[model samples]
Target: MLREIDVVISTNKDLLGLETLINQIKNQSGKFEVSIIIIHQYRRVENLPKFLVDNKILYKNLAEQNLSNAKNEGIKLSRSKIMTFIDDDVSISQDYFLSSWEFLNRNNCDLMFCRINKMNSNLPLSRNMKDNSKKINYFNSSCCLSSSMWINKKENENLYFDKNIGLGAKFGSGDETDFIFSSLSLKKKIYYNSKVSMYHPEEFIGLDNSKQIYSKFFSYGMGQGALYKKHYNKNKFLCIYLYFLSLIKSVLGIFLYLFFFKLKNVIKYFALFYGKIVGFNNYKNIQ
Candidate 1:
């Protein structure tokens, strides 16, 4: 009766998506026993699906609207040896759980970053997708996507996401990167594999709202900035190099987009650059 895996999902008002994801997990074919832990935030509990109420799933609600807080809460409640954190809006491949279980045990992995593709398409959700599996390092830690991560709780018992840098938090989006940085600092065995995959909706695929696009990219940039500051003391040289590297890339993107007359992309890069400056300066206040 031992639980082999705990799938932790933090959501806010995405009831339909939650139901779909949970059902998908239930339908997964595997020899492993998996438990579902849902950390719902920022709303009164609604009448959940009968299956959820009748099943042995663990569901909790929080008053605050913080992604990291919700995920941390899930971590505390999880009782399985392996834990997988996934977004509610995503769906897993047919063999997701079995593949992840096999990969973890076969490699003796402490933490794993899996591939994420756009729903109904072969295109990757994150730009960091790799063609092959390999051990993660400080230089390549950017490949750590939170949407489809698998962690061996027995190996990483103390692992937790940073509360200051995720959706609804001040910095607003580098929780996974910060987690990877901490793991690497601890000499944890982290790896990235394309075999274990999930499918998510493509971001801004058909969206026409300029303000929404700007806000999204800006928030992400702020999180990146705060992450650099948070770990600057641990490795000043790396932090400095990454900060400038990001700044340079953003600048180049702005100019390149401008030349191509892609106004939206120009705005996106500009917002990222500006947000980084603001987040870097505001880090002291938050700390």
Candidate 2:
């Protein structure tokens, strides 16, 4: 009766509301065993509340500030066949685990996908992710955030989180997407199970008409640039096409805003397009 799934959550100093999130996971009505682990992203462990230590919850306090690095460490510590990542700012429904476990057991795929509810918004991040039972490799359609990803340990042992690309690293974001793309490139099967889900708080990504949004988009570009550098000559057309297409998409959105005399996101889109072009060239020497 060993646990088959490990839900790895990464958090920093902001640990005020984890009790409710942990309660949600504890209440999941799943047949298979699930171990919820929290990795304190900061170097110091003394600040943690006593309840975490007294409850004997499986937790770790590492000095590493990298998000992917902490997750990779979770893989090393997890004693399960499946590893799923969630953020500190998320909660899950009762059926989240059971559905994911059932889907993985039935399909036996290397990767599993579930629904993501923006605990703050009515419309989902993407509408294509239906409640249908199916398998697909959609590169640009879905993001790794809302739909928390599940990884089969046996199939992805050689894959490690790209440390230089996640939060607190060179690129302030794009770590999860990098991990997903890396898994896909390994020829592994990814299954999308629309039933399972988790709740991400209102500001999961801080995406909006704010100045901070530019930094968010910039981090993505830098990370994407590093990815492009890694596979510059590998996918030639497909890779470059995606880069150009992303740039064009943002640039077009900026124009649409200007036409309407609404200048709220003009700088934001420009920053995104600029980040893509800059990210494409910035990491060429490193990877």
Candidate 3:
């Protein structure tokens, strides 16, 4: 059974916890053809695996685009029917391709959603995933998998990713969310499978209240809000009203954090809240 799949990863040169991950894939035990496409901007990491540099892989140096654009580059280089999106900060415990092969093949699924857990901690992960068993209308872009995922090679030649909408030059957020929603609008089916799992190592302690971080999140919220309003619900007034309410609630969370824990996260909390207050576009302009 030759399950040919292309693995796509977008990363900077500063990935810290990927040594074990690279080793695991190099030593994977499976009967599958796997190709790795990496979009990287840095040249500091030394001693990359032979599999990555010598053969069975494509390397593109992107010094201009954001993560979403890097992902698009990977998609363009991929020749396999199925494309797997893996983060740079993660590793696999088993044969990464084999774990998801049976499930994806049996279903002949266009989109096979994988499960992810936190690394080095007991804290539960959060997923805004659908609960029902039927094919979902949309999904968060955090960890999405696809077979024939890109729109088209020629007609949608510019379909790598919407640079204007996703994480732009500054590690822009919401690329995954934007992609998922856009795909759903085209009436694509996205399915969830628990068998495929990966570890997402958490590193950010708390979100900074800086203009950059807050603005980025606000743009993310706005993108999410627009999606919700356009597809799920058409109540524009309600969406606007809820948007303001969300801002208030975020601000309130800051005071609560300070009052209870006596922690100095005011800057972080306030930046996030203010982003919501000014709206996503306003936040983007500051960037």
Q: How does candidate 3 score on lDDT?
A: 0.55
* Candidate achieving the largest TM-score: 1
Clashes counted in candidate 1 amount to 0
Misplaced by over 4 Å in model 3 are 14-18, 43-51, 127-134, 138-159, 203-270, 277-279, 283-287
Kindly provide the TM-score of model 1 when superposed on the true structure, using C-alpha atoms.
Answer: 0.94
Per-residue error (Å), model 3, residue 110: 2.4
Best by lDDT: 1
Error of 3 at 75 (Å): 0.8
The Cα local distance difference test for each model comes to: 0.84, 0.69, 0.55
lDDT of 1 by residue, 34-63 (tens): 788888885687767776784558888898
> Per-residue lDDT of 32-143 in model 2, one digit per residue for the tens?
5767788887757755555455343688888878888888888788777877887777677788777777788788777776767677554454555565656655354343
In candidate 2, how many Å is residue 144 off?
3.2
Residue 152 miss distance in model 3 (angstroms): 13
Off by over 4 Å in 2: 1-3, 54-56, 126-134, 202-210, 257-265
- Would you list the rank order by lDDT, best first? 1, 2, 3
lDDT for each residue of candidate 3 in 15-44, tens digit (9 for 90 to 100): 344456556665676866777777775644
> Residue 103 in model 3: shift from native, Å?
3.2
Worst 10 residues of 1 by lDDT: 47-56
